[model samples]
Every structure is written in C-alpha cells, then in structure tokens.
Target: MIILSVESSCDETSVAITKDGKEVLSNIVLSQIDIHKVFGGVVPEVASRQHVEHMTQVFSEAILKANITIEEIDFVAVTQGPGLIGALLVGINAAVAFAYSHDKPIMGVNHLFGHIYASQIENEMKFPAVALLVSGGHTELLYIKDHYQIEQLGSTLDDAVGEAYDKVARSLGLPYPGGPVVDKLAHTGKDTYKLPRPYLNKEEFNFSFSGLKSAVINLVHNAEQRNEKIDVANMCASFQESVTDVLVDKTKRCAAKYNVKQIIVAGGVAANKGLREKLAEQIKDIEIIIPSIKYCTDQAAMIGIAAYYQNKIEPAKKDYFIKGDSTLDINQS
Candidate 1:
C-alpha cells in the first residue's frame, strides 16, 4: 500500500510518502520556526498562512522525491485534530481536495498517534508499551495495549513541558524553540538554581508543569528585581534538571506499575539531550525506543505510519473529518 501524508498541526508544513507502514519513501518538512521565533511561540494565523503557501510545493517535492506518481498513491492521510483549528483546517481541506481529485481513500489521523508512530522508524512497536508525548502543545502519558489500542492514563494539567521550556528560556533571554537551546547550554553549567519538580510525587500519571513554570518565572523575575546577575547556563541546567527529573520519575513509575514491554519517546522535545540521557539512565530494565531525530519532530512519515496502524483498527473516511478536538478518543488495539 502507498500512503501520502500531510501534517499542518503547527508551524511545520510536512509531507511524506510511505509504502505499507514501515518503509519511508520521502519525507519533507518546511519549518516556520524562523517565522514564529520573534513571537516566542506559534501564531495560528501565521502558521495557517505559511501552510497554504508551502503545502502545494511540499506535496510535489514529496511525490517527486519518492519517485512515485499520484496514481501510485493508494491512500491520503492528514492530521485532523487537537491542534490550532486554522492550521488543522489547512491540512484537512487539502486532504479533502486531494482525495476528491484523486478518488483515493482518505484517513484522518490523530496528531498524538503521529508522535507514537515516530518510534516505528526505529522498530516495530511491542504490545503493552508506554508512549510519552512531550511537545510544544501537549504532554501526555499513553498506555498502548496493542497496535490499535491506546489509552491516555494522564497528561499535563496546565502548561506542557515544551511550552514551559520556551517560556522559561524566554525569561532567560534565550531564543524561541528553547528546548534544544537550553539542553545545549545546560551542559556547560551545573544545576545551581534548585528548580521545582511539580507533581512528581503525585499518585497518578498526570503531570503539572504550571507550578514548575511559575516557580522558574518567579525566580527569574526576582533575580531581575534584585538587580542580580543571573547565570543563564546554570539556569538552563537547573530548569532541565527539574523537567528531566519529573519526566523520568513518572515514566519509570508507570513502566513498573504497568509492566509495559517498551517505552517509546516522541515529540519535538524527544530530541533533548538531557531528556535522552536521563531516560537512558533511568530506564535500565525496560526497553527504550527513541526515533531518529527526523521522526521526533512533526513530520508526515510519522503520520503515514499512524494512519497505517489506525487503518488496521478502523479506516478514516471523508465523513469522519474532525478539527480542533481535544477530546478525540482514537481507538487503540
């Protein structure tokens, strides 16, 4: 089977061509991080407009790179929900139009599932796995009972880890997309700030980054008010320590509690050097699956793999189109 995938769930406009579920033919992503950098976050309208401009060229590039014809594509898939509505619509309407034009089967994929499939680039998913989705907009703990069955055990009660990273980085005068930036700077200094790790001791898998966020914000503001010279590198180190500690602790607890066979890490923050190192140290007994950095961030190849798996459980059709759905319950195996 051949699938062409589109992902416009955020500032990145991505397109991919994949065969069956595992073989990636072509994956092209045009990032608007440069455009959104000045704002310190994604702007929905700017993202939508950029998608409109790049979507066409992305599709063409992906197809040519894949060395395939439109007729060779047996299915079209797109991320359908839990994202900025305008950004989501750009991809959805594009998929709807492509499906109409090509008379192909259309699949509406959940964005979280796309993150899960990023692990597929490395290896096939094992049953009874755990997925940690840490992205700009979300931080979710998912229990994968099987290939098609996914259950959300817990998630962020307030700001996501990536959001917190960007905000904290901004407070420290770091650039936008601060997760990697902080990760790099953190290596140069010690964790001297003693940042808080909120809700780590909580009895559930749920996360609470808002408290951690506020704690860091207060510290940063206080340093400025006192006319104190803040150690930027140490601040990054301290912030990342708190974030990594919370994530690793919770994930390890969940892995032990559920007896899961594997843990797959996904999303943009999956590229964090600290998170990866901490996870490696913490998850010694269980299998740890991390995708190639290409798959870690938002891309259509990940969406194509997700659609292939989703199709195994239930087919996505034109009639089931969804947009901006935070409560979407995508069936798992």
Candidate 2:
C-alpha cells in the first residue's frame, strides 16, 4: 500500500511517500533549524507560519519524487498531537483537506509512535521489546508487546534529556540545539568535571534530568564567578557522561526486568553517539535497534510507517475527524 504522510509536530515541515510502510519512496523535510537558531530555540508562531508556507510545496515534492500520482496514494497519515498545537494544526489540516479532496482514508498518528516505528524503516522490530524514547520534548521508556501495542514503563519527571542538553549547552555558551554540539565536543575531552548522575539510586524506571542540568549550570556559574577558565570539551564530556549513564542504566534495568527480546532506542536523542555506544557496550545480551540518523529526527516517513499499523489495528471511519492535541498520550494513541 502507498501512504503519504505529513509531519509538522515541531519545527520541521515534512512529507513522505512510502510503499508498504518500510520503503520510503520520497521523504522531504524542510527544517527550521537555521531559522530558529537565531532565536536560540523554536518560536511556535514562526514555526506555524513556516509550516503554512511550505506544506503544499513539500507535499507536491514528495509525490513527484516518489514517481507517483496523487491518485496512487492509498492512505493519508498525519501527526495529530503531542506537539505545539499551532504547528500540529498545520499538518493535521493539510492531511485532512487532502484526504477529503481525494476521498481517501485518513489516519491520525501519535508523534511518539512515529519515532518508535522509525527503527522499523531500517530494521524489523521484534516483539516484546523495550524502547527508550529520548527527544527534545520527551523522555520515555516503553514496553512493546506487539505491533501497535505499547505500555508506558517510565518517563522524565522534569525536563526531557534533549531539553536538558540544550539548557546545559546554553550554560556553557554553546549554540542552540545543543545535543549534537555537546556530543561532538564530548569526543575530544575526558569526563573530568565530575558531574552527578541524577536518579541513579532510584529503583524505579523513571528518569530525572533537571538535577543533572542544574549541576552543569551551577558549575558554569561558579567558574565564571571565580574567574576560572572553563574547559568546554571536558565540561561537555562530563555532562554527556552523566546523562548517558542514567539513561543506559535505567534502560538496561527495564530490559532485564521485562526480559524483552530486543531493545530499541528512538527519538531525536537516539542519534547521540554517546548513548548508542554506551547501550551497545553495556547491553550485550539483546539486540539493539537504532534508526539511521536521517530517521532519528522528526520525519514523515516514520509517520507513514506508523499509519500503516494504525490502519490495521484501528481503521478510521469515513467521517473521521482529528485535531491537534499537545498533550496526547502515547498509551492512548
């Protein structure tokens, strides 16, 4: 089946044409990274406006690149929530309009489910797997018993890991979208700053990054107050080490507790080299699945893959209606 998917849950306005969910015939992502970089982060109004401007172009590009006509599309899928309402609305409305015009089936997909299915683009996911989803807005651990069946194992109590990474990077005078920058710098230095690993002693699967982020902030503040030269590389390494340690540890514990067949890391933060390396090294007994870097960030191909499954389990009605829901829960998807 051919599916055309739209994703505008965040700063990216993406459209993808996929065949059978796994093969991405065409994926067009118009990123607002450079635009938001000037402001140090995403501005919701600006993102919404940009989405409006680019959605149709991306949609046309995806269809053209996929070498398919609009009539060939079997379904239309879109991210419906768990993101900025304004940004989400742009994609949702676009998908709804397209579906209505074409008289095609429309499926509303959860943004988080899109991230989880991203790994399926490259690797076939095994049942009874544990998923660690880390992103700019969310950090969650999920247990997947089968396709489209997910249980929330744990989540961040405060700031998400990606958010913490950005805040820490800002404190260290790093650029916006700090996760990649910090990961790059970390390879050049040793973890010598001695940062604390938050929630390490907690027996539950929950995560807490606020304490770790605060530690980095305090260290940077103290160095400035004392007029001490801060080592950016080493500081980045130290912070990355602490964050990865907690994430890996909790993920490992969950995998063992559930005795899952495989472990999958999804979301934007799953692209972190540090986290990937740590998971590969520490969790040796089970298969580790991480999507290609291109699929790690927000993309419509993942949404298309998720829609394929949603269609199988919960078919949409002819009069189906959807709206942007900022707080949409994954368990309820």
For candidate 1, what's the RMSD? 1.9
Best by TM-score: 2
TM-score of 2: 0.98
For 150-244, candidate 2 gives per-residue lDDT tens digits of 99989998999999999999998899999999999999989998899887456788888999999889988998999998999999999999999
RMSD after CA superposition, every candidate: 1.9, 1.2
Error of 2 at 87 (Å): 0.3
Q: Which residue pairs show backbone clashes in model 1? A: 148-332, 148-333, 149-332, 149-333, 150-332
Worst ten in a row by lDDT for model 1: 324-333
Model 2 deviation from native, Cα RMSD in Å = 1.2
Evaluate residue 275 in candidate 1 and report its C-alpha lDDT on the 0 to 100 scale: 96
Instruction: Give the per-residue lDDT digits (tens) of candidate 1, residues 1-333.
Output: 889999998888999999889999999999999999988888899999999998999989999999998999988989886688899889989988888888887877888888888898779789799888898888888899987678888888889999999988888888988888999999998999898778654679989888887888898899899998899999889989999998988888888889999998999899899999999987899999989888898889999998888787677565635433432553422
